[model samples]
Target: MRIGLFVACITDSLYPATARATVRVLERLGHTVVYPAAQTCCGQVHYTSGYRREAASLAGRFADVFSGCELVVTPSASCAAMVRTGYPRLAAREPRAADAPRVLELSEFLVDVAGVTDVGAHFPHRVTYHPTCHALRSLDVGDRPLRLLRAVRGLELAELPAADECCGFGTTFAWKNADTSVAIVADKIRHIGATGADVVCALDDACLTQIDGALSRLRGGVRALHLAEILAAGDPAGDR
Candidate 1:
C-alpha cells in the first residue's frame, strides 16, 4: 500500500518522533510511507481561536497540499479530525475553497482501510489509555486504538477511569485559562495514578503534553507514550 504521511505541524515540530514512528510502523508493515513535506497546520488553531477568515485561508492551503495523496494518514488525531470534521465546516462557510481531500487518523486507516486485526508489535508494560477529544468526539475513533493496543504482545491494558473524558487540554483551552486547566488536569492525574499504570498512551500530543505536564508538576510519575511509538515496536522476524 502506498501511504502518504501528513506529519501535522505539532508532530512535525514538537514531537518529531511520533511522526517518525508513524513512518516506521507503516514501513515495517510493508507499505510505502511518503512524507508530504508540503503539509502544515490544518488551520484548527486559527478557527478555534475565532479567526474564521484566516482559518479559511490556511485550510485552503492544506487542501491544496493534501489533494494529491490517495489516502492521507496523520499521527495527530486532532489535526486529522480538523481536516476530516473541521475542514468541511470551514468549507461550508467559504464554499469557494472546498475541493480538499478528506483526512484519516492513523487508527482509522489501520482498522478500516488496512483491515488489520493485530499489528505484530510487542510491549510488556502496564498502560492506561487517554482518548483525545478530537480523536473521540470529532473523529469518532473510539476503542479502535484500544483494540489494537490490547493485542500487543505481553502488554497489560489497564482501564483508565473516565477514559473518554477530556484531559483538560483543548489546544489553547488550557493556555487561556490556566487555573481551570490545572484544576481539570489535577483530576485526570489522580485518576491516572489510581490505576497504577507505568505509562499512559494516547493518539493526541496536545492532551499528552497537558496531562503529562501535570503529572510532572504534581510528581505523579506516570509517563505518557504515543500510540505510534508502541505500534513501531514490531519484532524483526515478523512474529511479534
Candidate 2:
C-alpha cells in the first residue's frame, strides 16, 4: 500500500525520530511510505482555539497534500483525531471533509487497516503507556497500541495506574489553565512514578512533552518516549 505519512507539526519539529520511526516500521512491513512536503498541521489547534475559518483552510491544504495516497498515517493520535474528527466539524461542506475517513492513527493503521500487530520490533525496557485523550476518546484506538507493544520481542509492558486520566496537555489549555494543567500533570507523574517504569510511552508527543517537563522539574529518571520511538528500537539494521 502507498501510505502518505502525515508528520504532524509536533512530530516534525520536536519529535522527528517519531516520524522516522514511523517510516521505518512501515517500510519494514514492505509498504511504500510517502511524505508530502506540503502537509502541515491538521488544523487541530486552530479548530480547538475557535479559529474555524483558519482551521478549514488548513484542512483543505491537508486534503490536497494527501489526496492521491491510498491511506494517510500519522504517529500523533491528536493529529490523527484532528484530521479524522475535527476536520469534518471544521469544514463539512469543503472538499477536505471527505479526507477525514482516510486518515488513521499509527496503531489504528497497523492493527485495523494493515491487519498486522507484530511489526518485528524489539525493546528491552519496562515501559508504561499513557493513552492520550485523543487516542482513547476521539479515535477510539483502545488496546491497538498496547497490542503492538505486547508483540515487541523484549518489551516489558507495565500497566499505568489510572491509565485513562488525561495528562493535562490539552494543547492551548496548558497555557490558558496553567495551574490546573500543572496539578493534573503532577498527578499523572505520580502515577507514572508508581509504575517504576523506565519509560512512559504515548501516541501523542504533546502529552509526552508535558509529562517530560514535569519529570525534569522533579529530577525524575523516567524518560518520555513516543510509541514509534519504542517500536523503532532494536532495528536489525541498527539504523534507529
Candidate 3:
C-alpha cells in the first residue's frame, strides 16, 4: 500500500527516531511510504491549549499537504489524534471544505488499512504499556497496538496498572502546571515500577517524553520509547 507519512513537527524536531522507525516499520511490512515535504505541525499543541483559530488553520494545511496520498499515517498518536478528532471539530466550525477522515494514527492505520496483525518484530524484555491520553481517548486505539505487540517474538508484555490514564503531558500542560504534572506522573511511575518492567512503551512520543521526565526526576529505573521503535527493531535496517 502507498502510505503518506505525516511527520509532525515534534517528531521531526525532538524525536526524529520515531519518524524514522515509523518508516522502517512500514517498509518492513512491504508498504511504500511517501513523506510529503509540505507537511508541518499538526497544531495539536495549539488546539489543546485553547488556540482554536490557529489550530483550525494548521489543520487545513495538514489536510492540504497530504491530500494526494491514498492513506495518511503518523507515528505520534498525539498528532494523529489531533488530526482525526480535533480536525473534525475544527473543520465543522469552518467552511468544511478540507475535512477528511483518511488520516489515521500508526496503530489504527497499521491494523485497519495494512491488514497486518503482526509486523514480525521481537523484544525479549519485560516491557510495560502506557496508553497516552490522546492515543486512548482521542484516537481510541487500545487493542490495535497490543495486537501487534503480542505477536512480537519473545516479548513479555506486562500489564501496567491504570494503563489508560494520561502520563500528564498534554502538550503545554506539563510545563504550565508543573506541580500537578509531576504528581500525576509520579502516580504513573509508581504503577510501572510495581510491574517491574525494564521499560515502558507506548505509541505517542509525547507521552514518552513526559513519562520519562517524571521517571528521571523521581529516579525510577525505567525507560520509555515509542511503539514503532520497538517494532522497528525487527527490521534489517537496525534499531535507532
lDDT of 1 by residue, 1-240 (tens): 888788766677788878878877777778898776777778888889999898888888877776776778888888887776677788877663477765788888888988884777888888888888888888889779988898888889899898777788888888899899888888888889889998898998878889788888767567888898887766553222
Worst 10 residues of 3 by lDDT: 92-101
Q: State the C-alpha lDDT per candidate.
A: 0.81, 0.88, 0.81
| Model 1 TM-score on a 0 to 1 scale | 0.93
- lDDT: worst 10-residue window of model 2: 92-101
Off by over 4 Å in 3: 92-97, 218-220
Best by lDDT: 2
Q: Model 2, 69-153: lDDT tens per residue?
A: 8788889899888887777676665666666538888999999988998988888889999999999999899899999999988
- What is the per-residue lDDT of model 3 for residues 74-125, given as tens digits with 9 covering 90 to 100? 8877887777677778877554415553778888877888888678787777
RMSD of each: 2.3, 1.5, 1.7
Q: What TM-score against the true fold does each predicted structure earn? A: 0.93, 0.96, 0.93
* TM-score (C-alpha, index-matched) for candidate 3: 0.93
Error of 3 at 136 (Å): 1.3
Clashing pairs in 2: none
